[model samples]
Target: MARFNRKGTTKVLFVETIADPGYMPTATELGTAIDYSKALAATDGWSIENQEIETPDLASTFVAKIPGDDSAADSSLTFYEDDVDDDIETNLAKGTEGFLIWCRKGRTAGSKGMDVYPIRVASNSAQVSLDNEAAKILVKCSIIDRPLQNATVPTGP
Candidate 1:
């Protein structure tokens, strides 16, 4: 298996935590909260991709892709303290505040990809924090590729 730096690859904050606003919402709560609205937008609901599961891994993937010709093969990404489970989210932890994401220190010409760190939300109340009060996370990620020697290199001369 190939190793990657946690500072220079594609990073995506999938789901970005389910803790909506007002009150942190459980997955079920999220369903209920959007119930009325979804119903109202039923006609245009096609835009909404609504497949839910009890597992956060299945919740949704907020893709953070690095624009390029090759994905995955050229870049690698990781999530730091990416998990905000019930025990930690509600209980809090020593080194985690919000969430962190790390990218490989450089780019790849073959492919760029992101690795997901599972976040096991233990409970609704403990794991979920909604609204403005919800933990604000700052995701830092980058795509550092050696300048394409042959590709168009636009520069100010």
Candidate 2:
């Protein structure tokens, strides 16, 4: 999670179905989520939505434009994941079809030997399988956050 410049601020842009969020967002709820993202982006700036970065691994970002006048458009949202390959697209498609879009990709570049990255998610695998609850298992098992640099040399398990 990117930290806010102002301290203790976190941008949490969840892309779950309305069924998961439990209730529809009131004006107050929208304000809270939007405000949080803007606050966090002020720090290091929000990464592109539904994308990942390695070297220093990162959570995904979700793009959003806070509903308002045409002139007021916001951008980017943060999400957690198991690994860079997890599909965050289905989460984006949930209830808001044309209203929003989630761009899912991974940003990989490192030392010469560490640069070769593999696409781990199966072509047919659905994004919902990587929801927070499921990813929690991968995180807890430490499989998703594998040591990329360390794995290259293979100093023997």
Candidate 3:
């Protein structure tokens, strides 16, 4: 197996239209690529919970467990604040906007190390300090569906 590192990783986000659930923004549709890798510090939060319930049977000492509904994927992204336009601040300000995020984790082409997530930005906040420290933004988002793993990058318009 080949080991991958984050040195050459890249991340892009595409705004999705509200009317069409199947609408995926293409490169031509997007006009310009919005790369957030520079400001993005971390991509954390992807979880699935299977709620198990124990059977209430008295005959058996061992209880039988049944799986319940799976919980939605909730994710958080941290970004290092910057002054440039189209940066984290601008993106986060687009509250409740649906977005598709592509995260590529390999340096070379043909590398099959990518993850695509469909998400809606739920909330965002930034902190400032008097000390000589850079500002940071924390964005909380909820996944629309299960993420596509090792998927090809979306084609351009």
Best by lDDT: 3
Flag the better candidate by lDDT, 2 or 3. Answer: 3
Q: What lDDT is reached at residue 61 by model 2? A: 61
lDDT (tens digit, per residue) of candidate 2 on 24-92: 332232232212222122211222222323232244465443433222112323334336644343333
> Candidate 3 — what's its lDDT?
0.62
Write the residue-wise lDDT of candidate 3 on 1-157 in tens digits: 9665664566555555423344434445434546666677776775556778888698888889999777655688878877665456665664666555565653233445445556777778876668886777888887777655664444533
TM-score winner among the candidates? 3
lDDT, each prediction: 0.25, 0.24, 0.62
Tell me model 1's lDDT, rounded to 2 decimals: 0.25
Q: List the residue pairs that clash in candidate 3.
A: 27-157, 28-157
Rank by TM-score (best first): 3, 2, 1
Off by over 4 Å in 1: 1-10, 15-113, 122-157
Worst 10 residues of 3 by lDDT: 18-27
Q: What TM-score does each of the candidates earn?
A: 0.16, 0.21, 0.68
Residue ranges of candidate 3 with Cα displaced over 4 Å = 10-12, 17-32, 84-86, 106-114, 129-132, 154-157
TM-score of predicted structure 2: 0.21
**Model 1: residue 1 alpha-carbon error in angstroms:** 19
